[model samples]
Target: MSLAFLLLTMGLVCLVAGGALALNVRGCAHALERKAAGNAELAMHARGELGQPQLVMSARLYRCLGTVFVLCGIVLTPYGFLELA
Candidate 1:
């Protein structure tokens, strides 16, 4: 396959991976909130100065995946352009 095709394929893969990560993170956050809601202590703790560990971890993962996707897209664009040249 041509370099352009390869780049496009990789870019699409990154986007899909990032989307999946984001969805997973959102799901986890919701679940954690729901679980914490049942326990007043947990809910209070989550709302206090210290945030929910699970939610924070999930957000970090989502952020990392999003950054990777963006970087991949940016890199692939140049590669695709070069291939066309």
Candidate 2:
């Protein structure tokens, strides 16, 4: 019920979400590889380069977000626990 407990809960939620994001990204990358197959352009995009740059950017963004979320969750949860105790 305390602020600390709220922070802890939010932190855990973020951590879990981050983990899911990571898993999703793994699947996405695999799918991209498969889709690229023998297409030079598509393969370039899959490699995060000269084709569909957005794909690369998006993947990087998601990965960055996942890391940030997990880190924030780790920091917040411990701090919340300390406050609660």
Candidate 2 per-residue C-alpha lDDT over 1-85 given as tens digits, one digit per residue, 9 for 90 to 100? 5899899999999888876665665576345444444365666767788644233335555656678888889898988889887
For model 1, how does the per-residue alpha-carbon lDDT over 1-85 read when each residue is reduced to its tens digit?
Answer: 4878888778777766655554655575345445544465576677783543443334455556666776777677677767877
Q: TM-score of each candidate?
A: 0.44, 0.58
Off by over 4 Å in 1: 12-57
Assess the local accuracy of residue 29 in candidate 2 as a C-alpha lDDT between 0 and 100: 36
Error of 1 at 83 (Å): 0.3
User: Alpha carbon lDDT of residue 71, candidate 1?
Assistant: 71
* Ten-residue region with minimum lDDT total, candidate 2: 51-60
Distance from true position, residue 9, model 2, in Å?
1.0
Error of 1 at 69 (Å): 1.9
